[model samples]
Target: MESRKLQIRDLTLRDGQQSLFATRLKQEEIDKLLPYYENAGFYIMEVWGGAVPDSVMRYLDESPWNRLRTISKAMKGKSLLSALSRGRNLFGYVPYPDSVLEGFYKEAIANGLNVMRIFDALNDIDNVKESIRLINQLGGIADGAVCYTVDPKEEHTDTTVKKGFFGRLFGKKDEIVEPKKIFTDEYFVEKAKQMEDLGAKIITLKDMAGLVNPSRAASIISKLKSTLKVPVDFHTHCTPGYGLASSLMAIIHGVDILDTNIWWFGGGSAAPALELIYVFANKLGIEVEVNMEAVGRIRKELRTVREELHAFDLVKNFPKEFDPLTDTLPAEIDALFDKAIEAAKADNEAELLDACHAIEDYFGFPKPNLLVKEAEVPGGMYSNMVAQLKALQAEDLLDDAMRLIPKVRRDAGLVPLVTPTSQIVGSQAVSVALDRKKGNPDYSNPSNQFISLVKGEYGHTPVAVDPEFRAKITGSPEEKAYDVSKYKKPENPVLPEYGGVKLAANDEEYLLLELLPSVANGFLKRRRAEEWEAANAAKKAEEAAANAAAEAEKADDEPITGEVVTAQILPGTVIEVNVKPGDKVNKGDVLLVYEAMKMENNVEAGHDATVKRVFVKPGDIFAPEAVLVEFE
Candidate 1:
């Protein structure tokens, strides 16, 4: 597969002139701009519109028709001079008939326009066909521009027309359903095919609002180029960050021509400049036929224009700073903008504007040339500022104190005085230290000195001072010599009484628990009772099993001393005993039953052993160590 080479069309003289105020260039300026574009290899130049001679002539001292003839004669070679015309309003404010459009087209061709770009805000196919027919009659290449600015609501649908007819015939009420208005790939494809059929040599997708995204551009351009036999071109503005993305996608999807500015004149609100396209095209292996050196020259010239215009305060009214050399904006400039933003958040407008001015001055312009116009801080910064303001208000230094003292405190390793004990003393100490550091006079009385010592030292650290001593010093009105007797010091005062021990059993621990009193009264009572019962039951059962085993062992050692050993009770045989320690038994009585697996055996006393004891009964299960019986 062979790769297609992309071509650049400079719209700076046309589009750039439109964006500027009334400062139109003279014929000399236009002549100078031509060589720059020619050197940049832009052969297709759109000079002026033909429909409105009066308005177009307002910018040039020479008539627009005569100027085009002169430019065409001066600029030799295969360079084509083109003019833009509309079937209706050529001046963008008034509407004219198709005959008027035809006459204007003929006159522009006669005056030396080799190409005609017929455009309309609304996609009226009849007007497009009439214009294309006129251009074909005059032996000039016609380019069809489909403007996307037409209100989608005005889009007509066959289904809607059919429904309206059916409703009117049936005497039904008029249905208020809105017509389908979404511009789809199918719609653009159809429009492209229609333009091609109307003898349009080229079809352009004119994106007025810069709303086209990359994915949409790729899909639409791919479909249009594949469906339409003519070459497809893209013209768009830079808005909402889609300009560069849309351009790249269009190129990848097979767009033949791209409209761009030489420097800062042609982009959207923040679109990539022409230099970016050249750089990107090289990296992507696409052969761009634009002269890079010429583009750089244009950029410097644009900067000169921006500086001259800003000198007159014309550029200052713009909301954002405009940079002609998009590639040269240093990363440090962004950091400076951030600093300016922070300074602005502190309500230092002078500092904020100063920072803004630095950026403007660096770019060789005034304010309102950058992308972001306003400085905004996050909620956290705002909250901190509010808190600092509150503190300043409380200290009654709201007039002279810095608005952002906490930021200074954090940077300086100064802790905030939160507690009342600390607030009274620590605040005074910090104030005195700050004032002294600033070379301010500090007048501390004896009472104020005592308060500072008590709170600043003891209130904030581990050392414990007697509260009574603090009271004596702070409360004394006479300001006389210190009375050591008034201050009662502890004999064996534990350091825990001060701030050493974090958890004091009776003070800190109990006090915290008291603060968050339990709300689950019934649940707590039941849980405690259940835990106690389970513990007691387990203890009693363990002790009883031990006692029973000990007595059973004693009985087994006696070995039928007072009674005959029953033959039914053999060693290693399992049995169930019914008595323990002191039970009476009669002669020839069965004392216990023994079982192995499911089979049962009985043990009968040969002679009455005075019937000492039985330990196991019905439902009583035991291991080998578990006692069954004990004899006296």
Candidate 2:
């Protein structure tokens, strides 16, 4: 059989870690695997972008720029290094000035990034137009990504309207309703063509939620192949269980490249496993050019890393013998059997709960359930919803929120559910659900982001937003796109010293501080502290000893009696405070609202009490476990 070589872009380091563990894969862990990745001969290795920059600094206390440079240097000429960019957003949620984007792209390419897959959540080419041009000018391949989403209605098909005998006699004829697809093959094909015309070397069908089925994947891939002059790549997730099938269909339909991962890191919310795809591709006379030996070594190393990062592992209860490839369990025991045995033998329920919780703190927040294949919500979006509801102690509102998502999305001009849009819609849906539960009318308390979305601050929506709905969300029905040209960069953009050390020494550090101000500042302070401790070990030890002695001397004093509620999980900015001094609160009442991980979290009261004081107010940033409110 004549061999058909199929190109594969590995997502193990970027999107795989992102989907599985909130992009908390440490630099050291990546360093361990970088050598193998360079020798593996993948068509493209996704080393940076997505949630990496923010997560690295926000959680891991590492520089995102350093990671990009390190990976680029390792993979210099061995293989292509690609990063995911959110178009004009450029890894941040809101749009940045062209000058900022230009600087970021220039720095990114200079740091050794070879390709940048640029995408817009709204599928509005206007959002990505400038980024694509900027990347190409910087000598990086711009893989233009068109977000894929299905219409809320049923699959498009011809509908027959039969006329009755009296109606036929009255000259009314039987009518056939043609299949009208909002997100049709033609629709995607046209979007791909537009990107191609804008000088995009490659077109990508980016199904972030794993929502595209095999049929649609084939149709889109075929249409893209026929219509676009450039190569077509498919990037989907395993959330809806459509990834493997859709990817196989894409390969069969002549897709230029496919996004896949290695076994353990892939699947669940990530992409399809490369090992499985290789077997299937081989059967179809397609050759996947990757070193199986390096993959095996990487898998072994990943198993160790997976155990170390078990708190973020989605499948915390997997049996060793359980095979993910065939979805088979060993004859001797299964996951259920292991769970039953552990439950029966466990002596302490508290210990078990503690163990479970430790694993839930992957990115300093609870990991979402990975079994969202049958769920109405995608994994990432569903996780955010659950986290937000859990924060408010409104777990019962999950059902209502999920039900409201479609309506909310429809009203938002049927925008593709990705990134900022998905989070915006999901968060607003929860808000609407909470409002309805509070006996208020729906959309009564829309979030600031939701209002911005309806006002076209992000970009144009796929369909024209309903004028009435737009007015209801935002006071005006007028639609206006945010003019990036008018954005003025601050005169003093350099980050101030944190702990007497300059936070940003160069353009890369400056970009970090610019894109994620709060996280970067916090990380820089922590870095300074760590460096101080390392450099002055004896001085730090003496200071720690003195502090310990002082703390012990003060321990004998009478303890404060008020119950203090501290921030849990991760650091966040206080957005609103509901409780004031002398205010009474119940166990479930929200004391304050804070924004964390892009979701607004409501800090609720644990018991009935009078509010003694609020330590944090709106715009105040707090760390995890810092006292937020004091109750009497």
Candidate maximizing lDDT: 2
User: What is candidate 2's lDDT per residue for 328-370, written digit by digit as tens?
Assistant: 5344323332332243234233332233223223212223233
Which stretch of 10 consecutive residues in model 1 shows the poorest summed lDDT?
371-380
Alpha carbon lDDT of residue 270, candidate 2? 82
Cα error, residue 369 of model 1, in Å, equals 13
lDDT of 1 by residue, 423-513 (tens): 2333343454445456775423223533543433221221233455445445532223323244331122123322232221233122212
Give the TM-score (vs. native) of candidate 1.
Answer: 0.45
Q: After superposing candidate 1 on the true structure, give the runs of residues whose Cα lies further than 4 Å from its correct spot.
A: 1-3, 21-23, 50-56, 59-62, 92-99, 150-179, 269-272, 306-632
lDDT of 2 at 571: 95
- Please report how far candidate 1 places residue 228 from its true position, in Å: 0.8
